[model samples]
Target: MDMVSPHTKNTTELRDRKRTGEILMGHGYKRGAAKLIGVLVALVGFGLVHGRPVDATDKVRIALSVRNVVFLPFYYAKDRKIYHKHGLDVEIIQMRSDLQLAGVVSGEIDYTPAIGPATLGAANSMPVKAVAVLYNAPLFSLVTPASVSSLEDLEGKRVAVSRIGSDSHRFGSLMLENGGADSKKVTFIQTGSTTVSLASLQQGAVAAAVLSPPFTGIMAEKGFKVLGRSRSLVESPWLGLVTSKQKLERQPEEVKNMLLSMRDVITAIQRDKADVISYIEKNFKVSKANATESYDEIAGVIVDAMFMRDDQIKKYLEGTHARGETSKLLAPEDLFDFSLVRGLK
Candidate 1:
């Protein structure tokens, strides 16, 4: 046999490497050092003409204030693989609203679905901006012991809220104001969460508590009086998705994918009432009856598009100012970016 030339020998070696890589891949070895080496061999053999290497899927971290039904859409999106369908790997973290702001601004967290007070932090020049409204009306209700018949009865009594500057407190104050009761006369004790607020109410530490569903439903089931709901008192954007403006500008596609996922979630909420209730029952750890009650309270107000109208943002800003949370009144354009939602169907 004739001796093979050096060039032919090199070509034969590359072909052998390519065949080995294909065999390894065919044997279901698509990970670890073997996969890396296979990819390298293929790259060197094919040269740059084979096109660029495949990029890893993007991962997004989202924070939520609490595990409540208000964020049903997000829960649904995760459980139903909607985020995966959008080509994103989403991680949901339960964090306090105060902490979430810092997370978003520092780029530690990519997105947050926050309440009014938390979202208002954007007005203070925080890097985050509210991109979409999740809940148009408040989800909280002033629940009291059976002895108290109405909001008027709780004038001199102590009420429990999540915190002083929290959404629960805002809803409680708004309810008191709408009920024509003096909010100042009613002391708001901070219980840290709706569950703790309920505990406080049950233990007689508080006469009433600003509890959102399914806690509110539990209270009602236990004979607590539903004194009033925040929906009647407040119509501002109670909850919404917030992200850094930098992310909005630099990662427009990711932001758009997130909003698209949300849009689908909202549509699911509207079209499939039973599925939403089931999700609420599973995620919130509540009874089906409680889930249904919670669903009924928010179904009509769940927004398909995250767009906040001029009046809605103005009302939110006014409410924020009224609570003394922020003195500066920012316009809708200043606090929100409606461009992302505009493209969503």
Candidate 2:
């Protein structure tokens, strides 16, 4: 047999070394991890090219649809970035109606700032729960020209509402019926006015319209009179925080933390109105006067009441339900999951 050359033996040794390194380092398997890395890099690049969506598990998403003066504190909370300060990655989206349940069930959002209607939704099997009570009571009213003089004058005259089934429309009807007005006698107009219901009356569209402040303040300054105010303390309603049952079960810690954050912000608002008014004006595009006045109004009427002084959650439901305002009675538990407010600071 021919003697093996030393150079050939060295070359074979090098080849063996290379094969051994490959196998140890997972060469065939490298493609699996490399491909994963490449896909991740491409995804990150895409997000950079466009906009990165929030990390679902890491972000706290909330949807708010019940809009108005009662809900203004949420705007203040959002505009001020209070949720973030509390170790939350919070997102606030504005929706035009009480569509909280769809988002809750589908996981499009983690919670809603308005929990009143969600109380109604819970009764209907939407699998949602309230995290906290924002306003201790309702903050809505029917405003009209001072010339109208009384709620009686509102009949036969056209009335304006944001939509057919909005809190304004439903509660306005209840207010009228409670005051003994025939619902059919008044003409209802849909104007989509969220915060400026008073403007509807100014524009000569209706004799009376539901309103929230700064619009309420503006109308009062402009010589309009208050017709009916939604008063939860004396048989009205409350707005609170709501989320899907799934969120409650999956991320109870996050939900609790967010509520604590919100309460801190709310307390801060009262604690520092001058600063909060500046912030509200900057973010909401309101007149400085409106911001200042509205902030003051909210302290007495909206915040710090725990859903009404008497806490008659049942009486409110009975009052509204009897007047055909809401379809049925709502359990108090249906309105709030106080564990967060009760447990967390």
Candidate 3:
């Protein structure tokens, strides 16, 4: 696979390569200072120091829970060599939410971008903290076949989620309750992924499924009824970077560099619209029109500076109440540390 060197690229001309078979942004206009002040006190680590490529010696591993559109930032970054530019030989791996957390906490995985599981894990007293907030709104839709006209109609029907304690479940439950439906009456099957959930829905194994774009678009095209979209049903932080407390304490430079690279991705998306839309089209295997639609729906939710407000953090933590009462008590400070992101240009 041809990889773009982080040191050079016309942002507009960047193209995504085939993922060796796996499926898998700009506003830019700012640069961090040159010279590392040591990880112990460096607030803003090396990211874009005059667009110079840092030594890519920081081998980092990031675990992705699913291949959803919300994770487009991570995918785009690797494709565009943003992490490499920041001195990170980042490896993106797919893992289940449950396992992703374990990997992060055990130092097996440096970071996992599934904010829902990470926040809930922190609430449950896990030693992991979110470093950034990517999407503040849930980009999911509670979809069912055309026979299901409303959220209430799904009572006693089966629903498909990625996993029992995963974000898909949380979003699905909230989508139902916020729509005045009894979530308890619905049976949620752990399909382990949106693609599987979609299969369950199509196979008649479930009556509804919580799916993100472009699955929602595909289902809608097939005449599925969208009872409610989570974006309108609830406001909560969806995806972002999360790492073990140990990583934060021991390798702050890696953390800060990762955050800065993410900031770079967000800024790139803000400035280059065509590249992202094209990426959506190829990455998601959707029509040009569908890709454009997904881009429009997802672009607005990307966070600025990868930081969420205090209130947004509270709301997001509250959304995990179903996990346990302890989840409701986790304050923003306990789950997030935006120092790295705050110091970026």
Candidate 4:
């Protein structure tokens, strides 16, 4: 009111604020501010900013039902450090097929390559899904002794399978049926594992066994006859990248990165067959020729992309119910989520 100009009033207020700051500094406010800044800097240095580690490599555990050439993409990714390239430290754990899906659901395993188990788990309301498929063909062979000339000869004889309700038994039955024999007539003995099943076939414990590579090649080399190869008759999504729904929903970026690494590994394997063959030979301890055979079988079936086609999904769904078994069948969209793989492309 007494001609107090706006500029003069603002300058007076600024000076008052500055004087207050100086007084507080004299009372140790400056040291407190400096300590706070130091703490923030330390947190940033330790990658604890915003409650997450920055640029940290994700440690992922992928469960393998059993080691076979169909699972070569995972092995190739680890050997070539492709997973590391995508900021992943992948540990390939070998576990029994029966336990893999349960492990995935229980959070003990992050992902599993056992596509059949993954699909079945989803149909039965397990908290899992098959995100991507790698091999879309059944890669098993019904191996028998020289005396058994045909699938019919397998009748009344004990055939070896890793387990009664295992993929080996299912696919082995399909192989027999495709060969014009009755799968029900043959007895499927649980041998605990494929390695043991192979041993059983070798030791004359079982007349025939379902074998995947390099075991298939191993048996062939020992003069065991391959009565039929499952791939020729059955074609469904075999090896796949499956994960719990929680992981897919909560940590999509991690899932995408893992799939990207796998997609790149598939490309590399397709581009350089020799590299994968060499890996098979060195890792599985098979002959170069046997490795090449295994590579040929696996290479032919490796999906060109991570996402499954409608027909492939249909084939997979149909294959799941091949034994005329029924369950609360989930829709394809509910059972599979390829959006992440689709987004990557």
Quantify all predictions' global Cα lDDT against the true fold. Answer: 0.70, 0.59, 0.70, 0.72
For residues 89-192, write the lDDT of model 1, one tens digit per residue: 88776656666665565444578777464445655555557888878887788888888867888888899888887777877888988888899899988877
Candidate 1 vs 3: which has more TM-score: 1
After superposition, candidate 1 runs with Cα above 4 Å error? 1-55
When superposed on Cα atoms, how far off is each prediction in RMSD? Answer: 16.6, 19.5, 10.6, 20.6
Worst 10 residues of 2 by lDDT: 1-10
**Residue pairs in collision within model 3:** 25-268, 25-269, 26-267, 26-268, 26-269, 26-271, 27-267, 27-268
Clashes of 1: 0
Cα lDDT tens digits, model 3, 1-345, are: 011111122122202222211221021223222122232112222321111112345357777655555577888898899988988888776555566666565444578777776665666666678888888787888999988778988889899877675667777888898888999999999776666777789989999988877778878888888888888866777778888776787778878989889889888877888999898777767878777878877787888868878987777666466447353577889889988888876
**Per TM-score, what order, best first?**
4, 1, 3, 2
True-structure RMSD for candidate 1: 16.6
Compared with the true structure, what per-residue lDDT tens digits does model 4 show for residues 164-219? 77777888888888888888899999877676787788899889988787778887
Worst 10 residues of 3 by lDDT: 1-10
Estimate the TM-score for candidate 3. 0.80
Clashes of each: 0, 2, 8, 0
